[model samples]
Target: MQHKHGISPRMEHYSCMVTLLGRAGKLDDAYDIINQMPFEPDGCIWGSLLGSCRVHGNVVLAEPENASNYVLLSNIYAYKKMWDGVNRLRDMMKTVGLKKEKGCSWIEIKNKVHMLLAGDSSNPMMAAITEKQ
Candidate 1:
């Protein structure tokens, strides 16, 4: 449809297509789309693919460079009681210096947004917020 309208599909479009295909259990099709895209797949595209891989229990497509992919695959292996796989992934992460990033979140109060990291208490208003709760 895009080609018919003389419009070129962009990265986001390709990523969305890949995500849809993956969700539908069409991983091979999604992978083919990624390979055939004119532009190199960016982090978002790879991330989507990795997420789908997790959903489909297909870690063979995961690459080591993407820390998140390794983490997800490791978690899947752990869930399936595959200790060796989990340990191997952890060792790989250590060798590559890819520590999983801390998870953070944001909330809005009184029209202001506050960023919060896990186990964080450094924010000036943290005490106040905790007291209020």
Candidate 2:
């Protein structure tokens, strides 16, 4: 379709293809696409591929230093109840001092913006919120 429209494939396009292929259990095809891309695959591309691998229970891909990549892989291992894999990933992160950045989100309620962070418990109302939830 891109060729028909004369729109050259970009990194995002290749990444999408990899993701689709991975989700379809066509991991080999996805890997081949990554290898055959005209340009170097960026972290996003690799991350997508890794996510697919996690879903499909394949861990043959190379590990990148990106914290998010490790997090996704660790989650995958955890999903499969593979404590060894999870511990190994955790150890690697600790050895390299690679910490995943805390994610934050904000919401506006009645003209007031409230901020929240992943695993954040600093808020004074956290206990109340937790009890309510």
lDDT tens digits, residues 1-133, model 1?
5758988899989999999998997888999999999989897788888778878777677664578778988976776688999999999999978987666778776888888888998987777666763
Off by over 4 Å in 2: 1-3, 103-133
Cα error, residue 33 of model 2, in Å, equals: 0.6
lDDT of each: 0.83, 0.83
Candidate with the greatest TM-score versus the true structure = 1
User: Distance (Å) between predicted and true CA of 38, model 2?
Assistant: 1.1
Lowest lDDT sum, 10 consecutive residues, model 1, at 124-133
Q: Which residue pairs does candidate 2 place in steric collision?
A: none
lDDT of 2 at 20: 96
Quote each prediction's TM-score.
Answer: 0.73, 0.70
List, in order, the clash count of every candidate structure: 0, 0
